[model samples]
Target chain A: MVDVRYETAFTLYPYARSADQDADSPARHPVVIVGGGPVGMGMALELGLKDVPCVVLDDHDGVGVGSRAICFAKRTLEICDRMGAADPMVDLGVVWNVGRVFRDERQIYDFNLLPEEGHKRPAFINLQQPYFEKFLVERIRAAQAEGAPIEIRGKNRVLSTESYDDHVALEIDTPEGPYKIEADYLVACDGARSAVRSMLGHDFTGRVFEDNFLICDVKMTADFPTERWFWFDPPFNRGQSVLLHKQPDDIWRIDFQLGWDIDRKAVVQPEYYMPKVQAMLGEGVEFEPEWVSVYTFQCMSMDEYRHGRVFFAGDSAHQVSPFGARGCNGGIQDVDNLGWKLAAVIKGEAGERLLDTYQEERKHGADENILNSSRTTDFMTPKTEIAKLFRESVLDLVEHTDAMRPLVNSGRLSLPCVYDGSSLNGADDAILPQRTRVGATLADAPTDQGWLIDRIGGRFQLFTVNTDFKPEGLNLDLVDVIVAPDDLITERYLGAAEQAVYLIRPDQVIAARWVNPTAADVTAALNTAMGG
Target chain B: MEKLFTANIDDADGFYAELLAAHEGLSEAESYALNARLVLLLSNVVGDRAVLTRAFELAKQAG
Candidate 1:
C-alpha cells in the first residue's frame, strides 16, 4: 500500500553528501556490486563475511512490497546461515515440504519433498522478498559496524560505467546529483533489465516462453492446505493452470496462467480472478488480493558473467521459469561461487585469470537450469492437442502403476548442477555430492559456522588414501590433501574408502577424485585445473 | 537398492508421531545422527559438501 499522504509529505529524501572532501583514495571498495536485489545483497553478504570492502547500489527507495520470489532451495538457506541471517529468515518464513496438484477440482496427486537421509534445512521456504532483503541489509549494517566496508546507496542508479585495466569506474546518479565512484571490480546484480549489463553491451541470449502468467499475492481467509498447493486444472478456470503457495502471516501466493490469447491488462479483475479462486476453493473461502502482476518468463542466460574486472550476476546473468524456484536460488549460488573468487583475486591469492572461469562454469549451470525449467515449462504448456491428451493419459496412470508415479510427480525438481569444464573445477568428482558444489557438503574442505561461507574456506581438498602413491608436481596453493583414513575413514564418508581422493574445488564441487588413488593423479588434476 | 534419500512423509503425522512415540528410548546419539543426516541432505540440496562433511562428522562423533 503506497502511503500517498506520507510519501507526498516527504517530497525529497536525498542521500548523504560525500562529506569527506579531503579523504584520499576514492577507491573505497575492492569490489562494487551493482543492483541491490537478492543476488547483489547476497554478493555483499558473502564479501562482508570475508571482511571484503564493497559497495552495493540499488535505485529503489526501499525494499519493495508484493512478495516476489518467495521460494528458496536448501542451498540458499545454507548461504544465509553463513551470513548469520538464516535463523531469522527461517523464523520469518514457512517451511513447506508437500505439494498437492489438483485436476478438475479433485486432488489428483500429492508429493512430499520427504526429508532425505541428509538435509538440514527444509526442502523450501516461502518468504516474501522484501523481508528477505531486510534481513540481508541488516547483516550488511552489522558488518559495517565491524569496520568491514559495506556502503549501500539507495536510489543510486548507475548512469555510466567505464572499466579500466586495474579498476572499474561508475557514475552513480544519487538524488543530490551524479558522482563518480571507482573500485577494483564491479559486480552487477541488477534485475532482468540490467542497465549495467546494457552499458557493457553484454548479450543475453535464450528462448522466451510464449504464454503469459499472472502472479497474485493474496490474504487467504479460508481453509487450504498449508503446503504448496497447485492445480493443473481447476473447473472454474477451464484450462488455465494455477500455482498456489502459502506466504507469511496467512497470505497465499497464486501464479495464474494466462494463455497466449488473453489480454494482459484487461484480465485482472475481481470478476475474472474471483471465479478462478472460488473454482479451486469452494465458495466460502475469501481472500483480499494484495498484489496482482502480469509477466512472462524467458529461458535465457548471459553469454558472459564477466567482462574484464566487471562481473554480472543474478537476473542480469540468467532467467528460468518459476516452475522449480531455480531462478533466484541459482542466482544466489552464483554470488556464492563468485564471492570467494572475487575476494581471492582482489587479495592476490590467485591470478585475475581465475575470474574468467566464473563466466564459464556459472553460465554453464545457468543454461542447465534454464533447460530444466524449459522442459517442465513445455510439459506444463502442451503445444499440440495430441501432447495434451498424452499428458492426460500419463496422469491417468498415477494410481495404477508404480512406475508411473515418478512420471506424474517428478518427485523433487531440485537437482545438483554438475560442473563440467572450468579452470577452477578440475572435473573428476562431479557426481560426488547431491547438490550445489560451492555450498556446505564438500568433504575435507574448510568451514566454520562463521562469516566466510562454505565456499571461502579450504584450498580445494584432494581426498586421497596415501597408500596408493603417485607423483604430484608441487607449488600450487589450491591443492590440499586429505588422507583417506588414519583410522577415522568409514565414519567420515559413507562412500567406500576406494572412492577416496575427491579433489574439492574452492567453490566446493568435487573437482577430481581417484579411487584408491595416488600423489601423481592428484598433482595431475591440480595441474590441469590450477595451471600451476 | 539402498535408498540414497528416504522420506517417511508418506503418512505425515504418523511418521513424526512414531518418532515421538519412541522418545522414551531415544538417545542423544540418535538425535545427533538425525541432525547429521538432515544437515547432509540440506547441504546436498544447496550443493555444498563441506558443511555436509562437517555435520556428518559431528553427528558421528556425537553418536
Candidate 2:
C-alpha cells in the first residue's frame, strides 16, 4: 500500500531545457546553488531578494518524502519573514512554545521557551520539512513574477566542479543530458551526504555516536497538546529516551532511542517498531504509520566553510544531532550571513575581504551548535558508567527540588548567534541594553509599521528610536521610529538613554549603536561595517 | 574573582568527616553516585566558571 500524502506535494521547477544547454560555451551566473533543499532554496531566495541573479539545481523535481527537520526556530522564522516566505509556514505549522520533560511516569518540569511577550513569531514551529521547502519555492515563484532574476532547474545534478581564480565550472547531469554552467560563486547546500564535499576531498572531523534512533510519523486522531514531550528512562523504553512532537496535520512524530547493538534494518520495520509505539500509546488507539526511518547523527563540521570560489552551507558544512533543533536553523543563518555580503561584493560595493566574515561568523555558529548538540547527545546516551551516573543523578534530583531543574539537558533549544568580537563589529555603547548590543541580531519590536523586523533588511539602515536624529550624505536608509514612552521598542533598544541610534547591517545584525553620535561617527561606523 | 585555592572552610577536618559520613552505608556504585551529586552541588555553590576551571585542573593534577 502506498500513501499519497507522503509523496511529492509540489512538483516545483520541473526539468526544463535552458539556453545554456544549447550554447557552445557555459553560461555564467552570479551564484549557483547546488541543492533544492531548504538551505539551497533559502540561499537563492536571499540573493533573489537583493536583485542578485542566482540559479538552483537539484536532482529531484520536488520536495523529498518524509517529515524531516520538523522544528524551525524563531531565528529561522525571522529570516523567512525577511524573505517574505514565513506567512504560509506560520499558518500551516503547529506553533509550540512550551516543552515538558519526563522521567519514568512522572513529569519532571515544563518550560516556556518564549516567556517574553514582544516577538512576532513563536519560539518554534513544528512543520514537516516538505512544507518548508514548498513554501520557499512558492516564495521564489512570487519573486520571479515580480522580476527577480532567479532560476531553478529541477532534475539537474552537479556531477563535478572545478574552481578557478574567478569562477567555478560545474558539470551537471539532467534527465535530458549533461550540460555545463559556470558560477562566480558556487554554494553547496547538498546536505550531509554531499557529493560536492566528497569531490573536494574535504572531510568533517568530529565524533559519531553508535546508537540509532527510529522516527515514526503516525497519523492518529488524538488529543496531544502542541508541546514537545521528552522522556528519559521511560517504562516503555527503559534506559533510553523518547521524544514526541505534534506536526501540522494529524501526524505525530515519535522518536524512540534504540540501544547501541540493535539491527538498524530490522528496527524500522513496522512489525518491530509498531509494538513499541503501541506500548507507549497504550492499546486500543487506532493509528496508521505515515513514515518510518532509522538515523544516526554525528556532531561534526569542516574546519572552514569556504573553499576559494566554492562554499559549503547547512549539513554539507556541519552536521549535528537533532537534539537542539539547530540543524536547519544554523543552516538558514549561514546563508543569511553569506547572502548580503556576497551580493555586496558582487555588486562592487564592498571589498572581497567582506566575504571572509561569513566563514568567521558562521563557523562560530556551527561550533556553538555542535557543542550544544554533543552535550545533549552525551547526556542522552552516556558513554561511561560515571557519565550515566551523573545523568541519572540529575534526573533524580529534578523530581524533588527546583535547584537541579536547570541541570536537565533534554535540549538547550536554538537561539540566534551573537558575533561577539567579530571583525565586522563597530562602536558599541556600554550603557545600552546588552541584548541589543553591536554584533547581535536585532530583536523584533512593535512600531507604527507592523513589526520592526519587517521594515529592515535588504540594505543597510540607520535605525533610530525615540529621537529624530538623522545624518545626511550617508549611503543608507534612515528609519526613524518614535514609539510610546513605555513600549518594548524603548526597553529593548534603549536602556535609560533618552535617544538611541543603530547602524544595522543588510542582514539585520547591529553593526554599531550609540546614545549620541556626530555625523563623522556615523560615517566612520558605516565605512567600518562595509569593510573599509 | 578570588582564586579557588584560598582557605575558606573554617574546619576542614570536620567537613571531611561529614562528607565521609554522607556516603557511609552504601555499595561502591552508590558511593560514586553520591560523590557525583556532591561535586555537582559544591560546584553550583562555587558558581564562578573560572574558579571551577582552576579547581578542575587542581583535582586532575592530584589524581
Candidate 3:
C-alpha cells in the first residue's frame, strides 16, 4: 500500500475538524476533487473562479518535499496565468530556452526552443514542484477569500468510492476518523499510483521501462549557465545518459540513467550517488545533496478519463516519462481543459454531454504525450540491439554534420496540444495559419492592450481581428483587436485574410474561425462547441 | 508522393555494389552499425514521410 502521509516541508493545510464529520447525512458538493496536487488545486481554483462549489481532499497537508517536476512549459504557464497564479511562478522560476546536447564529453549542438518573439512567457521555466503546488494553493486561498465556493480538506484521504447514476459517493479517512460525502462529479487528480484508481478497479495499461533513473537535486553555488545540459554518454557515467537542469534557489537537478538492475535502496544513499555527482561536477566542486530519488517510469494512461461522474486528471489519467517534462505539464493542461467544462456543466451553461468531449480531446493529448515520451525513452534506453545501433549512429553522425543534429533525442520539449479533428471543433478558415486553427489553444502575441492572452478572460469570446463584423443575438464577450499592419497578433491569427472572426472557448481553445461568418454560422459553431 | 517501387536509382547494381563496399572491412557489429547509419542517412534523403512509410511497409513485407 502506498503511504499517503508522506512528510513534506510545508503544511499548507493541516487537518481540522469539520461540521461534515457530525452531519446526519453526507455533505453534497458540486465537485469533489481528490488529491490536492497541482491539478486538483488548479481544478478547484478554476471551478471556484467560475462560482462552482468544490471540495478538495488531500492526504497531505502541503506541498511534497523535493524539486520533483522542475520544468514548466509555456503552455502550462499560460494556463496558470489564466488562473491568476502565473505571476509568482514566473517571477521565481529559472527561465531557460536553450538546451545543449553532448555525446561522450563532446558538444554536438545547442538548440533554441523558442526562436520566435512576441510571446509573454518564455519557452520553459524550471521551478520546483512544491512551489508550483504552493502557488496554486495560495491562489486557491486568494479566491476563497473572494467568496469563491472552494474548500480544501487536508488529511482527508478517500478510502473508497461508490459511483451511482446521479452522483459518486466517497468514503474519506481523515486524522480524526472517517466521513462520507457525495459529489456531482469526482475528479481523481491523484498521482500515478492512485489509490482512488485502485478503489475504482481501473488499471493503467502501457509499457513499463526496465531502466531506472536516479534524480538528485544538489544545492551549490555553481556558475553553470541556465541551460538544459544532456549528455548521452559521459566519462563519469560511461555508457549511460545524464541530464542536468538548473532549478530555482541554488539547487540543480540531475538525472542519471541507471541500468535495468540496481539496488534501489542502496543507490539513493549519499555514499553511492555523491561520488557520481562529484565526478560529473569535476574534482573541486562543493555541493550539498538536497533530495535523492530513484524512479522507474512508464508511459501509461487509463483507457478513459471520464467514468460516469468520476473523472481522472493528471498522473492518474496518464503518465509519461520525465525526459520531456510532460508529467505535471500535461496534468496542468488536463486541469485547464476540464475546469471550464465542469464549471459550465455545473452552471447549466453547457450540457452534460460536453464532458465527454474532455475524454475525447484529452485522450488524444495523452496519446500524443505518450508517443513522444515513449519515443524518447526508446531512443534513450534502446531495448533492442538494432535500436541501440541506430541511436549510436545518430550520435556519431551529429559530430561531423548539422543534418543529424535534429535526430538527436534528448527530449523533444513539451508543446501545447492542438486538438485536430476534435468533435468540439467547428468551421475552420483555410486562409488562417494552421497554428491558430480550430481546436488549437490560441497562440499568444503582444497587442495594444497588453498581451493578447491576458485580454482573453476565462469566457466564451468572439475574438475578432481587423474586422468590425459582430454576430447578432450572441451574448459573448468580444476580444476586438485593431492592430497595425505588421502586428504579431495579425501575423498569428490572420494569415492571408485581411480580417478574421474566431469563436474561442472558455479554456482559450479555438472552437471555430471564419473570414466572413454569418450569425447563424457562429450559432451553429457555438452549439457544436457546447455539445449540441 | 512517389511510390517506393519507382525505379529512381540510375545504376541499381552499381548502388548495390557501392553499399556493400562501404562495409567491406568492418566486423559484424561495425557492419550492423554502418547499415543503421546508411538507413538513417537515406531516410533523411527520402524526407517525404509518405514515401518513407511506404518503403518501411514494403521492406517489412519482404522480410
Best by lDDT: 3
**Scoring each candidate complex against the real one, what DockQ results?**
0.01, 0.05, 0.05
| Chain B TM-score against the true chain B, each candidate | 0.36, 0.83, 0.84
- The regions of model 3 sitting more than 4 angstroms off are A1-4, B1-63
Q: Chain A TM-score per candidate?
A: 0.84, 0.97, 0.98
* Docking quality level of the chain pair in candidate 2: incorrect
Interface root-mean-square deviation, each candidate: 17.1, 14.6, 14.5
Q: What TM-score goes with each of the models?
A: 0.76, 0.89, 0.90
* Candidate 2 lDDT by residue in tens digits, A1-532: 1122235657877788899999999999989999889999999999998999999988888898899899999889999999999999999999777889988898888977765787888878889999999999999999999999999998888888998989999999877789899999999999988889999899888999979999999998977777889999899899899999999889999999987899988988888988889988879887789999999979889988999888999999999999989999999999899999999999999998888888999998998898778777877887665566656766765565454555566777699789998888999998999999999999998888888888888789999987778887766798889877699998899888888999999889999999988888999988888887
Flag the better candidate by DockQ, 1 or 3. Answer: 3
Clashes of each: 27, 0, 0
TM-score of 1: 0.76
Q: How displaced is residue A394 in candidate 2, in Å?
A: 0.8
Write the candidate numbers in order of decreasing lDDT: 3, 2, 1
Per residue, candidate 3 scores C-alpha lDDT tens digits across A251-302 of 9999999999899999999889999999999889999999999999899999
Model 2, A513: alpha-carbon shift in Å?
0.6
Instruction: Pick out the ten consecutive residues of candidate 2 chain A with the lowest summed lDDT.
Output: A1-10
* Cα RMSDs, all models: 14.5, 7.4, 6.9
